[model samples]
Target: MKLLKERIMRDGKCFEGGILKVDSFINHQMDPILMKSIAVEFVRRFASTDINKIITIEASGIAPAIMTGYLLELPVVFAKKKKPVTMENMLTTTVYSFTKNRNYDICVSKDFLRKGDHVLFIDDFLANGNAAKGIIDLVNQAGATLAGMGFIIEKAFQHGGEYLRNAGVRVESLAIIDSLDNCEIKIR
Candidate 1:
């Protein structure tokens, strides 16, 4: 993940209030080569897990999740921020967005997620673990086993990674930010 760390240092923007904006390459305007490399790394990290499906929250998480799913040759399912009218038999949960500073009701159809399936969750960033918790809730409701979680960038200064790891969940992050203080990016 050294390449990712270097890219973050070069292109990532650090703002006050512990925000690291990686829109230039990671999120908003994606770099496909880097994304593929990240996906390859995730596949390598979770290769031994019993994963049958890949899950992620919509929008920002979609790119990395899809890339990972493609690399693993697994079906990817993303939870919709707003439940569509046609969605039925869906499992829903509330997740607080760290960047948007709002709560979102994320939902996914039970048809895609079901019992006896092991799943890997992938996302662009892990800030406070709210979205991860929400995915865990949905997976539990579906009786699906969470094989592991992968994140492109993890704010290690936050509690998300620690909380998930302490809870006995396998979490892998490509680039971990030690601190984003005074508009400086510190990678761990």
Candidate 2:
């Protein structure tokens, strides 16, 4: 976690609307070594549990989820941002993106998730927690058990982490930004 915090301080940028632009190493462009380290941490964090699968939203969360699945030796499933014509049997839910400033639907095939699965949700960032909530809904619809949720970065200034925790969701975040005041990203 210290390594992640140091990397964020070195490479992260603070944008408008409290956005921490970590695209250089996280969402957009990626650092495989860094991701692997993060994955190892996730594996350690959830090692005692019986995790059958890893679920994440599309685009940004894919990389971390894949690395986590590989390390955990579990299958990884992601929710698609757009439903394709080829896919008919799917479970869908709406998630609001604070960064994008819009609400959109995310979809996943019903076949991938089952009633008894212990799913661990992985993502690159956690701000509004809507996307995670939507993914949780998909798991709920399948009657699957949610083992926990993990994130590379969490905007603690926002209510995302607290909301999920209050709901009894086990949330693990490597770096939590408590504040972004004075053009500085403060972490806890």
lDDT (CA) per prediction: 0.92, 0.92
Query: Which candidate should be chosen as best, given lDDT against the real structure?
Result: 2
By summed lDDT, the worst window of 10 consecutive residues in model 2 runs over 14-23
TM-score of each: 0.97, 0.98
lDDT tens per residue, model 1, 116-184: 989999999988999999999999999999999999999998889999999999999999998888888
Q: After superposition, how far is residue 79 of candidate 1 from its true place, in Å?
A: 0.6
Positional deviation of 13 in candidate 1, in angstroms? 0.5
- Backbone clashes for every candidate come to 0, 0
lDDT of 2: 0.92
lDDT of 1: 0.92
The residue ranges of model 1 lying beyond 4 angstroms of the native Cα positions read none
RMSD of each: 0.9, 0.8
* Model 1 residue 97 lDDT score: 79
TM-score of 1: 0.97
